[model samples]
Target: MPEKIIVAGVPVDTRHFIGGRRVASPDTFDDVSPIDGQVLGPIARGGPAEAEAAIAAAREAFPAWAATPRAERARILHAVADGVEKRIEELSAVETHDNGALLRSHRRGVMPRVAHNFRFFADWLLTLGHDDFETRGHTNHVSWDPAGPCVLITPWNAPLMLATWKVAPALAAGNTVVLKPAEWSPLTASLLADIATEAGLPAGVLNVVQGYGAEIGDALTSHPDVRRISFTGSVPTATRIAASAAANLTPLSLELGGKSPLLVFADADLDLAVDLAVEQYDNAGQVCLAATRILVEESVAEEFTRRFEEKASALVQGDPREEATDLGPTIHTRQLEKIDGFVQRALAAGARAVIGGHRRDGQYYAPTLLTDVAQDSEIVQEEVFGPVLTLQTFADEEEAVRLANDTRFGLAATLATGDRERADRVTARLIAGTVWVNCFFVRDLQAPFGGSRLSGVGREGGTWSFDFYCDLKNTVTAPNGWNNHG
Candidate 1:
């Protein structure tokens, strides 16, 4: 049975939102819940026109929002935080219904963190503190201003958290925005817009647009009025958006994918490394920086593989909505096929699946660990973006670094070592945007997060995001006795 959900106080098919109004799609597509392949609902299918309208609405609203006082805007943001808190249960239920995530996971983890992000940015806005930049000598520095409309394209895996990563900073910098939440799971983003509206955010400050990416995302990326575009997803898509934006000289912020490596040194904390390694791949190795590759010393490689495979084999795979399910079906059938192809490719190349090797049902793919994957194999070189991981063993510290930095991706890297010398040496060499010396995904809102090379350009989740999202114009005054005009 399809559950009835609301967005912006209006009933939407599958609860997707587009424009500032409530409406259903002319044609609907089944948004199947990943758990058990249960059909979630017939979500409306919006085309390019809907996407264009969303951009137009966002463009219209940018001027008023930019002129609004920062403090006032901050207060409205605080209300949105409160709304998210008040509607926590409702929001969690929608997420659980729409996604395969456990309700407990939603209630306990996702909601609170989202509220925290909203509050964190609100506090950050206040810290802007009426701008008291010091000017030395003849230079005069006043307050910097906002750019204009921004379009945020986020993915399904982390709908709200990633959306907040862009929205919070962009708004805090005083720019209005158009948000294109991933079509697969648009519920959270839709409801978030409603919550912002209820929280007294002036209309047009934020416009949530939902639809297929090729049409919607393309419209957003090439929208003439959109001064900034910040997106998080695959590299090929990021490359396309960058090219489109370059045509207009529009600034873009990209948070692309990664095939991050996790290094476990000889002198490292064995228990901690083992524990994190096993648990890291639990979310089906579907995280952007999930330490997909483990490059360990040859001595301990056998032990690590044994423990890792043992853990992977024992994990319970099923419905994400069920509290007992440790693992669930992937988001879609296409992803399952992608993962299956990687496994087959590995097997054909003489690689072995120590734990999981095949599919159970339509969307249910077992958590898999591939051993003896060649450096040139597709799985090792490309971002599988699924539950599959390829294992490798390294000889010395230098070999460890080489293996870790082998991939073209530079998103995040982790080091496991009890020895300070080994930890420092390996950490310094890992070519990732974020490196965890003794941890994984211990994200701080205050820390600037982004990637290097193909991973992305520009930063997010810090004061730096606000700085880059806005443009700075210089004003120079000439003194009466200044150099004579020639």
Candidate 2:
């Protein structure tokens, strides 16, 4: 049996970490485990007041922390990475229990990557250099400075990892941040706050506020002290945040919803295509970059569907804590019902399910694959965000590119092909920000990652991330005032 994670000496229902201290709230909400519908405990329920306090703390800590040397910031962030690594199992178990992510996935995939994100940014910051040039006999120096207190709002899916995507670079760039993890999955994020403090972060530099977005989200965005905001979630929420942030003219990085596609040409390795399609069902298909729409060459469409169905059908759905479970429940009952509605509407529109197509139990939706879905169908056009994939066939390369770019989303697109020429050709035309050839979900720390269209506003990885959390200032110096006209 796995031991329960002791967060701040409490077994569950963790409190918000504010100003480096655990704070309780008068109002609380029950955090039910999506794994088995069991009540984990009561999590702190906060509102505008809590959001204000968190922003105030971050605001206070920004100047001194920002003034800290680059070498020291790197050292502290490296320590944070080490701290997270040391508490892997404890944190992993907590995340899996709270978010319904399989324990194995957390152990082998997500948690390790979370630690690496911190370490990667830590090293990258050391190499961040100022640009210097001479213009009109004056030496000009450009440097990226901390953007001050910022708000980082992450979604429920892949909670800790996504939070790290925003948090690591913000801190690395010497900005203080208040992170609001999705109310549904706050356990690991709170644990990260504790780890940061234990790793020697200054009090109030990194704070975690736990509450529903409706109550506290706008407060964080609209707070006068918050200089920038980074959010990853649905398109609707992103619009709302954008409106609020605009009130202050706050700079924002929004990673909104995605209806990303996976393209497989006829000449491509059929085996690899099938494998990648099956892999899409991981994380219950709740990924922002998930292969929601599969575009395959008409020649191999039938065979590809047959093999994919077999593999997807073999995926086991059970308790997320179990090591062998492949697919887990949706984050909540509402998500499951939403997924079911998409499938039912598709079926009514004459699409046929190749395999498991319906919702099971309370929140478990089987890995479902649908065929004959119209290009404009709701399931094809919008993001279902479940373990459901819709298949469409394209006649030629031109049609494939056209069909792939048909949606409003332009977050991620994957193409599986053996030919490099074809890969280069299709990659350039795809509207998505990230295009993978012969692969899916392969990420590099140095690359700029985000969406192009309704998917997101700005990039959030590599130097782009460091740039986003900071304001660039250019200074020019000369021995005396020299007028070119004179």
Candidate 3:
């Protein structure tokens, strides 16, 4: 077994994984569990030196790993998937302990998706095709060349799943990676490094550096040797990373903040609409793509609000380990305070909370719903990444579309309509990168996934992932040329 440390009575490896080994940091920081405000363990505190070491390791390993056969790479990724599947329960519990998300959510969907992320990209690599065409008596061959060392900065909301979402494609593309998980949730990332090593991934192919972004993020992002970066986090942080990478001319794929909208038409089913609305409270409304700004048709706004209030109020909030729990605590006390501040400001600005709008205890923020909010208010315009939903009424489809597109964010949107024609028409008019009709959060790995406008910088999924992680090169060969010398 890898080096282990006791965290909240469980053995965990909190050391940095560099150069295919568990390395200790000279300094350490307390990793507090958000569930109960207790110190779980001491996480390795990595700084510029650690970052440089990991980058050098990835740089040293890149060429050999890139030269490996695609078949062997696929097999190793499959083995990693199998290892993740075997530890689903352990990972689920550990994630809940680390980030205060519901364990059931992790076990049921999140962890399983982590495994699938690796498996899907692994299989995708084998089936990936290149273009070869003959033009003007010359053959043009297109190839996807692996980029060098990459940096993946993942969020605390869905740590391992989102990390592997980038990691799988980067590794499958035959590039070395150094992952920097959010400070609030770093245990699962350490676990993932171990899993990848056990699955026969080559030494230095994947490294984990643990610390706050302020301490080590710049060192990784601004490194001249780092070729690409994929970050999933807040807009402010993404902005800083972009600035750092700009100095090196390093390419970046950013999946940032969202204040997305959900439109409910009068012709839609009330129960289904209400069900979808309540689903936003999952993970305490920390989901970036969640339909938090709900726009309901005036005809059914009253009924929808009534049903939504009841469901949101009835959601059981307690320990994530319990199977009966529907919602868990926010990631930390600071985040909880931020959520409360947004609700308080909205209330002072004349909005009414029909359900909940306060912090419950510890790190738990009550699921909140606000009505009569102004279109230009901060609560409506800013991303309140907590268990808060804002509702607005629209006179018609025109007003609904206008209201949904009012914000600068264009990450995602959801629409509920019975008519196919109306769905297509409104979906076309929506400014979001992803628009769901009569459904929400149903994702296919093969589809293009990302944001537009201020929500993100580039896309990631299927070919789009490879497009960012690899360099596309074209080679032209002379076809039976008579004269070679000119």
- Model 2 Cα lDDT, one tens digit per residue, 1-486: 112335324464367888888777778877777888887777788889899889888988989999999999999999999998998888788888888989888888899999999999999999887778998888998899999998999999999999998999999999998999998888888879878998999999999988898898888998888999999999999999999988789999999888988999988999999999888898999999998899999999989988887777788898888888998889988888899999998999999999878878877998998998889889999998899999999999999999999999999999999888999999999999898887889998899888988999998778899889989888889857667745
Q: Judging by TM-score, tell me the better candidate of 1 and 3.
A: 3
Best lDDT among the predictions, by candidate number: 3
TM-score of each: 0.92, 0.96, 0.98
Q: Candidate 1's C-alpha lDDT? A: 0.76
Give a tens-digit lDDT track for model 1, residues 1-486: 243545324443354344456555566666666665666556656666766776777777778888888788888888888998998787777766565555677788888888888888878877753333434544444455788989899987767878987887788778888888777777788778788878887667787866777766787788788888999998998888898788788998888888888888777767777777776665556678788887778888887877777666778777666677777667777888888888888799899888777898757777778888888778888887777777788888888888888888899888888888777777888788899987878899888888887888878775777677777755544344667776
Which parts of model 2 have CA positions greater than 4 angstroms off? 1-13, 479-486
Please list the C-alpha lDDT of all candidates, in the order they appear: 0.76, 0.89, 0.92
**Alpha carbon lDDT of residue 190, candidate 1?**
74
Q: What are the per-residue Cα lDDT tens digits for candidate 3 across 1-486?
A: 135766545578988999999888888888888889998878899999999999999999999999999999999999999999999988988899999899888999999999999999999999887768988979999888999999999999999999999999999999999999999999999989989999999999999999989999999999999999999999999999999999889999999889999999999988899999999998989999999999999999999999988877889998988899999999988888889999999999999999898889889988999999999999999999999999999999999999999998999999988888999889999988799888889998899999998999989999889999999998999877666565
Off by over 4 Å in 1: 1-19, 23-25, 129-136, 474-486
| Full candidate order by TM-score, most accurate first | 3, 2, 1
Colliding residue pairs in candidate 3: none
Residue 267's lDDT in candidate 3: 93
**Model 3 whole-model lDDT (C-alpha atoms):** 0.92
**Candidate 3, position 271, lDDT:** 89
